[model samples]
Target: MASSTPQSVERALAMFDAVADAPGPVGAKELARRVGCSLSTAYHLLGALTARGHLTRTAQGYVPGPRVPALHRGYQRHLGVGAGVGELLVRLRRATGAQAYYTVYRGGLITVVDSTAPVSDTAEPFVPGPEIRAHATAHGKALLAGLPRPVRRRYLDEHGMARFTDRTITAADRFEAELARVRGQGFAVSVGEADPAYTCLAVALPGPRGDGSVHALSVSLATAEFRGRRGAIRGAVARAAAELVPEG
Candidate 1:
């Protein structure tokens, strides 16, 4: 059996990434331009990827296929958060009458693993995505605060706190002070830092014993409601985090 060349593998992966990054189905010429490859090469690779179920082609161009969703579901299962975690989020949403979320920090990234909201006609569902800014979100702050001091400092240095809303904390010193407060209080709260209309409260959970991973649970509500029930929301989130800890 012959081994594949590194160049071939790199080119294939580059094409795949280009397709995935596109807002919608992309044409062969556009993909070729993005990947800096010949049109023929791009078409050949696209056809191969489509045949393998990694992509699906339509009259429009190509879109992620069933395999992508299947892979994503498998990855979620591998994370081990499970249906029970979803149930807990739902319960939290009901109790607080707000959007509930479970987020994890791994490899210097904070990702919302699960959420439960939209329980009623008046409520809006919490949707998690790649666009969430870690420095401005309550759960992201909670996860960051849970990190060791040196690691936290290094992260801040690498990713300079970019401002999102007017309330976003852009100063490193101020943000560090906020993290100190979060550590002391055992939770973090954000008021219109990420988005002006929403307020969020989050509590960090202990990750696997020796691992550096940090996980947090959060509740988001309308700013008006959050302002009125801040203390109650904080207590509720703290309790929920404690309850989520695995028993020995």
Candidate 2:
């Protein structure tokens, strides 16, 4: 589908995404290298994006421009989710003693919209976007398990389950059985499947949304600790989910 778009336009959008996903300001050279374009082409795209108010040049590097937040506001408005999810995640993290994330499945993609803020500098922050390995993440599995069997099959057929870690289930028959287990258990659990160091447990929000997006909340912690506290963590996520209101 993106092949239909002009090359320069596609590259510019790719460059913008690279910048947006970066932890902090990114230099043109790094952005160029990251986006697989020449320095001059990177500059041209940067200049165009800067003029369009999507990226801002700084003394150190480039940051998201003012238009970024406005666009994000529109996205939130369009989806009608994430209103109180932030606060809920904070409480969920506190209760679960693990990082909590809010995710939604819409338009055939699973996106992380919000997560509890890191309490320390060394704590990792969750990035909001669509990515791979649905069979390897608790939040992803929770959302996928909620969809109709046909829709789930279509997604798997297109994505072709890729393995991320030693525990990630890439075989179709096995993964489908895992999803069935998730449905019967009323939650999704991942034991170092995605990262090999963390365990995640996720529970989907009840019912359908006006936008037809499936939403879920998940918490992640050290695999060793999660093993001993599964009941407590699962209870915390489920309790927190009751407070979330589905947009009509």
Per-residue lDDT of candidate 2, residues 189-233 (tens digit): 999888888888999998787667888989888999998999999
Error of 1 at 211 (Å): 2.8
Tell me how candidate 2 scores on lDDT. Answer: 0.85
Q: Which lDDT values do the candidates have, in the order given?
A: 0.78, 0.85
- Looking at model 1, the pairs that clash are none
Task: Work out the TM-score per prediction.
Answer: 0.78, 0.88
In model 2, which regions exceed 4 Å deviation?
A: 29-44, 117-126
